[model samples]
Target: MGRRGDYKHFLPLQTRWADNDIYGHVNNVAYYGYFDTVVNEFLISQQVLDIHNGPVIGLVVETGCKYFAPLEFPQKLEGALRVAHIGNSSVRYELAIFKAGDDAPAAEGHFIHVYVDRDARKPVPLPQQFRKVLETILV
Candidate 1:
């Protein structure tokens, strides 16, 4: 598929000193952290997840990444997040890491979260409000 519009939500991420590698570029692994941060921040802001005491929690079932360019430390990143898919208790979160003011993405990836009951750890259907919030971000 072709590229779509930017995500409805954005989370700014500050690159740390330790994030850079010997090559002077941000390590690829750190992108995963950025992805997690952006999505979770959205969930929290939307009040869709309660990390400490919620009855439901999402467990990542799949993930992937694709790098388009290198990133360096001391640079602030704008992580654009959107929902690509929503299934039974599962959602695919698509992320694009962009340098401030740039239209193209430095990195793009997606992760699938299967929601489960906090206690039983069994798959559960997403709540109506939760799905509603995610739907606004669907790409």
Candidate 2:
């Protein structure tokens, strides 16, 4: 339901041939991949996430999506991202996918990530640096 302006950041995405199903559209599950890619791409690009060695890591605890229109392969896409909520140990990321240059979202959803200690896997307060980065995209 989000418009392009609702998001603070956008990442370009390409639909691969394998992403399409026999029905001639991108599968429902592929939308989730787009959502995940945009969020992590932003975090990594901002240097806040060290996936291979960071002591604090985020684990997805919840996620959802709603499709409004079909997306087909061989199309360019723009994945939009924003923060809906930030808590002591969790953050809710809202995301949407649109055909490149389109303002209306083809799909939209949210996912909650609970930051945890990499080894203990116990919930922990989000790192100050990470939290600050997320704040920049808060909505």
Off by over 4 Å in 1: 1-4
Q: Each prediction's TM-score against the native? A: 0.95, 0.98
- Candidate 1 per-residue lDDT, tens place, 56-112, comes to 999998999999889998998899898888998999999989888778889999999
Model 2 stretches astray by more than 4 angstroms: none
Go through the candidates in order and give each one's C-alpha lDDT.
0.90, 0.95
Model 1: per-residue Cα lDDT at residue 138? 90
Checking candidate 2 for backbone clashes, the offending pairs are none
For candidate 2, the TM-score is 0.98
Q: Tens-digit lDDT track for model 2 on 1-139?
A: 7799989999999999999999999999999999999999999999999999999989999999999989998999999999999999999999999999999999999999999999999999988999999999999
